[model samples]
Target: MTATGSATLHIDAPRQRVRAVLLDALSLPSWNPAFVSLAGPAVVALGTAYRITVRPGLKGTLAYEAMDLDMVRMAWQVPGFAETGDWRLVASGDRTLVHHDFTHAGPIAAVLRQAYEGVAELRLGRLAQVLHS
Candidate 1:
């Protein structure tokens, strides 16, 4: 079975600014605690690949590759995993609404769903702060 989750955050910044921050993979560890580091080629367009190391538990790291970045639509996918998601950016006035939808598969889908939601909220909060500042 698979589980799906979606979250949105309204950022007090222009769509371009929000997208810039989100695509800056190198700066991820600066604001996100779960990300240890990002390795691989530079970010291009959709299908560009990058490696990421994320903390899965107390002392383990889960390595995965991310690809398919639709910069124009502000969307992407984290391939090579049982989960896939897309980030949609909607510009409203001077702010941008970031909508994220993710689906997880496998037996640990429930646990991953909870973890992803919590992580997404935290990341969104951090992104909002950075954009506002």
Candidate 2:
């Protein structure tokens, strides 16, 4: 079975600034500790493929390819499990609303749901700090 989750955070930064951080693959690890490494082009674009590794030690090398991107949204494909994720940013006054949506199949589903339920708030706090920094 596939389990899914969504998380939203409000950052003091502007939407464009938050969106920039979300779109930058190189900066992913700084905010999201689950990411071990993202090997891809220095500049990420739609259709760009990346070799991704995750924490809690997931087995096997996970492959991801950018699916689509817009000014405030980006989606990617996890080809290994046929899963996908999306991030979106919306402007609210001077703040930005950041949202993340994820899906996972099989055992990974339980892991993801557990992670979100356990430390999602803490993770969002870290994400806000990263955006502020």
Candidate 3:
């Protein structure tokens, strides 16, 4: 079984700014608490593996699954989960439209639908704060 979700938000920041924060390993934990820490290159590159520690003492290696520089799109593999996530950025003046899509596969996916949506919304909302802070 698989469950998927998409969340989009217009952030009052340049596309480059939003893109930098979203793709940076060190910057993720500021907005998303699920990521406790990451040990790897600050600039994510294809084929690079980042050792990540999350809340509840879970740890795993994360990698860049796919990236498209020209299209301003990228995806990362989540550790210890049958899940995949991607982000697309579109710039308009000083604002950036951020689209985050997620796909999870597992027997518990149906049960996780509500929680996944809530978390995605929270993550997107917090990205703005991360920019200002």
> For residues 1-133, what per-residue lDDT tens digits would candidate 2 score against the true structure?
6666677888898877766676677777777777777777776666666676666544333333442333333333342343456656678889977676666665555555565553445555776898777
- How many residue pairs of model 1 clash at the backbone? 1
Weakest 10 consecutive residues, lDDT, candidate 1?
Answer: 68-77
> TM-scores, in order shown?
0.68, 0.73, 0.82
Error of 2 at 104 (Å): 1.3
Q: Among these predicted structures, which one has the highest lDDT?
A: 3
For candidate 1, write residues 1-133 as lDDT tens digits: 6676667888888888877776666676678776666654455445454556655532222222333232232222233235555567788889888876666665556556556656556667888887777
In candidate 3, stretches whose alpha carbon ends up further than 4 angstroms from where it belongs are 69-80, 107-111
Off by over 4 Å in 2: 56-83, 110-112, 118-123
- Over 4 Å off in model 1, which ranges? 57-81
- Cand. 2 Cα-lDDT: 0.61
Over all chains combined, what TM-score does candidate 1 have? 0.68
Candidate ranking (TM-score, best to worst): 3, 2, 1
The TM-score of predicted model 3 comes to 0.82
> Whole-model Cα lDDT per candidate?
0.60, 0.61, 0.70
